[model samples]
Target: MLKRQEVKIVGMGGQGIMVIGQLLAHAALIEGANVVWFPCYGPETRGGLAECTVIISSDEIGSPVTSTPDTLIAMTQPLLDKFAPTVKPGGVIFVNTSLAQPPKYRDDCKIVEIPANDIATELSNPKTANMVMLGGYVELMKPVKLESLKASLKEVLPEHNHRFIPINNTALDKGAEVTSR
Candidate 1:
């Protein structure tokens, strides 16, 4: 188990960036870890910059803001450009290959390219791209169990949208499948 882990998820507004951070925080709480989730976005409701910073640890957190993340998930090219340098050495980065290109070669961090939008499109729900990236992150990091993430969906998603649970679950599984290889 990680003593502490800081993550930053960045993408355009309306891409469910906040949801991914919330899901991770909820799962961490369920596992008895302390978590802090902070979201920031531009004035525009959509097609604007949005990002969430999530810190999970077994001990009490010192601060909610993250200047250097242990893990960075970039869902857009602009996000990738903005946050790639902020990842600490030995950290990992997950890039949405469908919408953004990987950063220039960097020996300080590991980069995992994921075609999240393409994967979600193949799943018939492009909105699920965030969930796919989250799934891959879970599988690669093993910070929380897959089952715990599944269970947290009920709490993270609103009641009116409960019917889409199965599709999101499948998206998570598909993402895990990609990372396991």
Candidate 2:
């Protein structure tokens, strides 16, 4: 059997949106899936729109861009509003309850609310909120195992930043824990 996932993650700059998307792409590749990570950047470097589309599939992928995503990960209210309507029916939306709430009108999809920022703060860095969201989405969707994601950190992150891996791992676990509850 083959598996596929089209994920659109939206957030502002400095939120590590691209990093999480890269993490997923790398993890998927590690699991023998062909993957693509396409990121978009707005005018401003910070507090500007940052979105990434990650396509992971057992077979080859023809397009890196997706008009409709099977999974939507929204880190803020505006981004959620902008992308919520585009998720395919029966898809899942992993929301950062610390910043965005699930849309009320979208009954066709499953909404998983995770207080990502709060969880990351509790873990000591608030910046790892993206990892928290990744954990939640991975727990629910299983596009790639959480362990695969953790392993990718070594490859994705620069050597000097390797020290943060432990907290990042904890954030991932915390996200899984919250979703399991």
Tens-digit lDDT track of model 2 for 7-29: 99999999999999999999988
In candidate 1, stretches whose alpha carbon ends up further than 4 angstroms from where it belongs are none
Instruction: Report every candidate's CA lDDT.
Output: 0.92, 0.93
TM-score of 2: 0.97
* Stretch of 10 with least lDDT, candidate 2: 1-10
Q: After TM-score superposition, what is the CA distance of residue 48 in candidate 1 from its true location, in Å?
A: 1.1
- How much is 112 displaced in model 2, in angstroms? 0.6
Q: By lDDT, who's the top model here?
A: 2
